[model samples]
Target: MKTESLSQLLSFLDASPTPFHAVDALRNRLNAFGFEELLEQESWKIHPGSKYFVVRGDTSIAAWIQGTESPSVTGFRLIGAHTDSPNLRIKPQPDLNQHGYLQFGVEVYGGALLSSWADRDLSLGWNDLPEKQNRKNRRTLFFIILNRF
Candidate 1:
């Protein structure tokens, strides 16, 4: 890959710490490429030679560009990929005070290496759901430095 493309990929990775954030980043990129968003709850008016994308549960996304030819004549091309990876996630009740230091309790979501995570900068990202029905959920990202004393 080119240096510029690698830099952009690194920036995207930094912006996406969780599945929700990754989908959000992908949606933005697709929008920049002229892909229109499609909601599952609504009906779609698909057009040939147009780009579109759909998101589900704030974590999953699918994007496609429609071909001008019919599927029976040209066939379809598909690609599949996932955004999640092994990482540490904060527990619901994460606050802890030990030895005059504040800390958070975390859970291993996948095959995360607990030892490798020690004494390094970490990022926590999550979707903040609103209590009110009319309010919209927000995406939150936080960074912290962990030190072994």
Candidate 2:
């Protein structure tokens, strides 16, 4: 695919609410640059000079910029990043009010600012599940107000 700056990627990622969304968006953009999506359920074999991508459920994804070399060729370029971010996530439940206020049980992950978790837009994506449509899915979007009060 046409190489884009990380800033471009970050903007794209920021626009996606879920990993499913991000991968879909990326696959589209990459299509303009000769990137082909690969299905995980099918047996895999790649000839040299083929650039391919694979998606896992709604979350994880991986892509490789293949040159005229085999896996055993010992040289390749790989750009790696995660499609998911942190938010108070768990299975659905009943009764969110523990006190007189709406409350959420949260567990923080990565370099997130705890104070900013509230009152801001957040994109979603993560490492779980596997689906064909998810290979072409992107859901939600976030607009964060980094500072409040």
TM-score of each predicted structure versus truth: 0.80, 0.59
Question: Which one wins on TM-score?
Answer: 1
> What are the Cα lDDT values of the candidates?
0.83, 0.64
Could you give candidate 2's per-residue lDDT for residues 28-75 as a string of tens digits?
777878878788989888867787888776467778776785556776
Cα displacement (Å) at residue 138, model 2: 9.7
Which residue pairs overlap in candidate 1's backbone?
none
Candidate 2, lDDT over the whole model: 0.64
**C-alpha lDDT of candidate 1 relative to the true structure:** 0.83
Candidate 2 lDDT for residue 17: 61
Ten contiguous residues minimizing lDDT sum, candidate 2: 137-146
lDDT of 1 by residue, 66-102 (tens): 9999999999999999889898777988999999998
**Best candidate (score: lDDT):** 1
